[model samples]
Target: MDALPRAAPRPHLPAGALGLGALLVLAYGIVPLTGTSYLFEALLTPFLALALAGLGLNLLTGYAGLLSLGSAAFMAVGAYAAFNLSLRLPGLPLPASLLLAGFVAALAGLAAGLPALRLRGFYLAVSTLAVQFFVAWALNRIGWISDDSPSGVITAPRLVVAGLSFDDPRGRYLVSLTVVTLLTLVAWRLVSSPTGRNLVAIRDNETAARLVGVKVARTKLLAFAASSFVIGIAGALWAFAYLRTVEPAGFNLDRSFQILFIVIIGGLGTLRGAFLGAGFIVVLPLLLARLGAALLGDGFDSGTLEMVQRIVLGALIVALLIREPAGLAALLDRAGRRLGRRAA
Candidate 1:
């Protein structure tokens, strides 16, 4: 029998980017059709928001080589800014408020990042941590942001845009998908532009970048501003679409570290890594808990299972870093290239 004719390879974008885009389309387009509200709301929505936050951090830490530990603070600024704006001006649209919140966060990022411009490495990181503590304190101390709630918790404003209310799970998921998609596209372009090249230069060697007229200081601040803008939007989405509640405790130091871990575990300086890392962060523990319950049945306690999950997660992160420091995105790229060669 004659062998089947070899199929021609179709031209495409980078495999990682194309594959991720397709996966997102499937997630938003088809996942809800399965009628799994838990996956959509409890998992995917938060995953997208966190991924957006990771992407923002990747821009600053991964691409620009700026060390930051105040991502959650920027997020808090975004959330509280949106909360106050929406509260003060009830007539504002939700989408508009989110955008404005992002800008406000950008301003805050510029302020916090300016002083740290003279610092580098560990000092820069430590400087950013001050923003985290200050923002958290401000949120609790400022009654206007929380509306003086006795519990110090505030509910998110109603999510309404153009006569559409995203109160339901599917609606929220769609909103998140739309926002993330657009922002991802913008980030992709930004990273490929001249600005991104300067960031790379600054990251590699600040002196060299300055010698070559990169305007190192200005670029560093811009990186922070751009990163904060995106993170701020993510924060708003996390509160308005995912959690539907805001408290200073929710955006703590741990939250900042979680975003950092996502960037590290996903693959630094790459767009696809953000989503990959978020999937790992969001799905791994849930899988572990299910496995524990299946194995231990009724004998398993929630606290013990959670502890086990943390241990496993830490071990896996260590293993992955030791094995492939570039993270899962690099692994997938390698796999895709091999398959393409085989197909050829």
Candidate 2:
């Protein structure tokens, strides 16, 4: 018998399957819940926003191998920029405000990255820290950025789309889901492009990349700018869809660390990791709190619950890292591989 060419292994679900699955799950969760379950929708908005931000940070820190501690600051910049554009600029559209906020944060990222040519590792980290502080300080210094509001909360103006106002939780949730979906698609495309490969190359070995004629400095700066821009948009969405408040304290160092942890726990260098990490970071705490409340009842103090939650979270993170350093995505990938092998 003529040698039969083995049929190409069936490809995994076509590109975007994972994204579509997530969207379906999100939609399913959002659509059926009664009023009493609105908290899920509320919580999901910020979770998705933070996930988008973490995706950006992963591009910088994981793919480009640039350690940045100023992601939250960029997010803050976008939030405040959106606030100012919406409230201060006469006749500015909300979309315009979001774009302007992203642009402003990108500029900030570029400026911060310029010094990266001279510094890296700990030095680069420290320099980004300066950006964090500088942005926070600037936010506090300028009253206009805060909208001069006594409460420092930037309530989103009613989202008017073609004369329809989206003020309800369902509307806001839909908006967040749409924005996050589009951005995640963009991120997926970007990471699959030549520039993404270049960024990865530089991350692996800057000297080697330069030896091969890669524009090392430019690539690094672009990575930084791109990452910050995405993070900025996420921040804008966060402010508009959920918090409706833009405050300096909200985008502090702890926020930055939390994002870092998400990337680490999710799967550094992979877009899937961002979603996984965000889910763990966001849902885990809430789940734990609910469990604690159920077990301990009303008499259980918040402080004890908080402490136990932290300890459990810390232990989980450590366990995950030790067991699968590549994060949850890697675990999933391995499972798929095993399944494929079994099928073959």
Candidate 3:
């Protein structure tokens, strides 16, 4: 009998996965001990939520090649939906409310995605803009969604889950971190599945994908639904866990742009890019302000400094995009491969 080819041994864990796990452990376990309330509540929590949002968009645009600009609108849907569910049901649990909120967002995503069946590229993108505007307007005009608040705002309820209130800074950070971690894992798995392969095919060439028996419409809608589900949950976390306030303006076009930028700058198709881009988005402004203070001294005009910061940020983004069209994730990936090759 012919000798069977030797089977290659597989590593117990993928490269960087173990490092990521250890980093997460340190983040969840030791970082809280630092007792930096500002970093925890103001920075890390918000970054996590935004990273989740980026991951959601990345699923659609990165893997599926469906561009979206209304991520914030879906997020708003989730925030308001969860708020109303918890408020009206009274007995509804926080986890249930969050899940329901995601469902609501998914429904809305389907509604928005339906139009995508007929449209392509720029037209489809433009169509989603309508959803963004319409949702924002609805939140402002519709009294019931906002609980008829005089300010057109909804204050988030206490994030109580089975007698545990995540009201403290560390608690809130942990909650956000946990949710983001789970969702990230799920997304990783999703992108590795058969469905993910179909979506990528559809993205690379819709006609070829259709020829290969892929259901183009179905795959696209699923992408939208799945993306919106995660984004919606992130939105709920943004409201209940991070800001503790819900306002339509908070999830406006600017927020949409920010999320899109995170995806773009983080690396379109990679999951880790979301976090890297989000961290850049969150910390860059602070760093810019400090740089301004250090360079020009505290006596520098605040407005002028703000304008300078924006200019610098814009320039940096343009330069980075021009230098590495695939974003920072690709750069890191290439560097890692080079190091491995050298080590070998």
lDDT-superior candidate, 2 or 3: 3
lDDT of 2 at 83: 76
Error of 1 at 324 (Å): 0.9
lDDT of 3 by residue, 86-182 (tens): 9999999887888899999999999999988998888888998999999999998989998999657999887777899878888888888888988
Candidate 2 lDDT, 1-344, residue by residue in tens: 54454332322122247856876675657563543335635577778888989988998998899999998998998888887787777587666778788898888899989988989899999999999998888777777778776645566676655566666776777677777777777877777777887998998999999999999989989999999988998888788887775678889998888888889998888888888899888888788788888997986677887788789989999999999998888877888789999999
lDDT string for model 1 (223-339, tens) is: 999999999999988888899977889999999999999999998888888989999999998898889889999888999988897789899999999988988888777887899
lDDT of 1 at 47: 97
Least accurate 10 contiguous residues by lDDT in model 3? 5-14
TM-score of every candidate: 0.93, 0.89, 0.93
- Check candidate 1 and list the clashing pairs: none
Let me know the TM-score candidate 2 reaches against the reference structure.
0.89
